[model samples]
Target: MFNKLDLSKELTGRRALVTGGTRGIGAAIAQRLLDAGAKVVVAARTRSDDTPAAATFVAGDVSTSEGVEAVATQALAALGGLDILVNNAGGGRAFLEGSWTIPDKAWHDSFALNLFAAIRLTNAVLPALRASKAAAVVNISSAAATMPFGPFAHYGAAKAALEYYSRTLAMELAPSGIRVNVVSPGVISTPGSDEFARTTPGFSTDDWTRNIPLGRLGATEDIAEVVALLVSGRGKFLTGANYRVDGGMTAR
Candidate 1:
């Protein structure tokens, strides 16, 4: 069993960078790392009031090549070097009409944010990751990847690609002592999701929760805690694995 109290300094002396770390799930991950005693730098297109105060903030969009380069450069500069990386930035709007209605731009944007960003940022930071004796990378995916739904086809497809990429990356980096893993969250309650719920016609949180074995939506901290464990010494042996923190929703 994992004990939160015992993990206060589990990541002491570690330096971390979390993409999309300004709010929601990304913000929670950054805060968890900071609480675990790691020097954290968060990268996003803009800083918000919710950005963690203790974490250094770098402004850059992960969805573009130029933005990826800028974020990687600035985050490394702020943290000096990186021991951990959490690719926690990803989202997409539901195309209620049908898959046919999802525009080319939507597909392109989805892939850019959910798949390419992680790949590009990792490549950019490969050198720093190689230098760390205990480096770990966690890519945030969505349960939608495996449980495909019509409205979320593009987002799901992109996340599915991310999972495939993460597995390949883990194998390639293993010999170099860099661990790579994926975390897929199910129906997480965040500001983004709340907005999605409000705007999405006929979308009901209660209906969604009924399908969850845990009988509730997941909190950002729920995902963050799992990520913290994966990057800590306790999970040194774990890599190339996908952890579904979805309150057992995927089990069914």
Candidate 2:
């Protein structure tokens, strides 16, 4: 049955750029794309040795304008061009509840990381995406965008904005043969999730996993497979779609 999925046929000859591809969901997406025969370039603030075969790595922070530009430049040089742009670099810790003590600076910082970073990077790669046969952009969103977990008010708001941005960009770029979409994932078991569990009081992994009807929290691969499909020809007719890969968390 696994062989029958035929995922590989969908991505031959494609070139992709995955931000934050050195770890977690981004790393999983890079591996899936490579398995499907795409040449993948990964960009992140740090480097990792676990990169898939034939993958190129570029170092830069994608949250700032300068960082986004540096990554785009390096990715283009490494991959020769970009056909798929996976905006998987955004993340932050604005989900913790704190009324007056949180400070306004924290809010802005969260948006800079989780929202502006994707916007800036996508903007930098528009021209290249336009030139490819399968021009697609996949923005990694969060279930919190709509679910409204109070702990992460800022994070949720930023993710909501990201969803809006991706849909609007889809409308504007469709005429140019480019597709844009979002993948909103639930709590996945990653190093980041482990860190969050450790820091956030009462937010145990068990607590989060219980919300998933699938009986367990999602893995990075669960999100990555969906992303690969969206950027592939198999997902050609899909755009402006926000898919919630949350193991049924949103269903309830």
Best by TM-score: 1
Residue 94 lDDT in model 2?
Answer: 47
- How many clashes does each candidate structure show, in the order listed? 0, 2
User: How far is each candidate from the true structure, as Cα RMSD in Å?
Assistant: 1.5, 2.1
Model 1 ranges off by over 4 Å:
1-5
Model 1's alpha-carbon lDDT is: 0.94
Residue-wise C-alpha lDDT for candidate 2, range 87-184, written one tens digit per residue: 99877664455534556887888789889999998889888988887799999999889886666777888899999999999999999989999999
> Which numbered prediction scores highest in lDDT against the true structure?
1
Output the lDDT of residue 103, model 1: 94
The global C-alpha lDDT for each of the candidates, from Candidate 1 onward, is: 0.94, 0.87
Candidate 1: tens digits of C-alpha lDDT, residues 82-154: 9999999899989998888999999999999999999999999999999998999999999999997888899
lDDT, candidate 2, at 125: 86
Name model 2 segments beyond 4 Å from true. 1-6
TM-score of every model versus the real structure? 0.97, 0.94
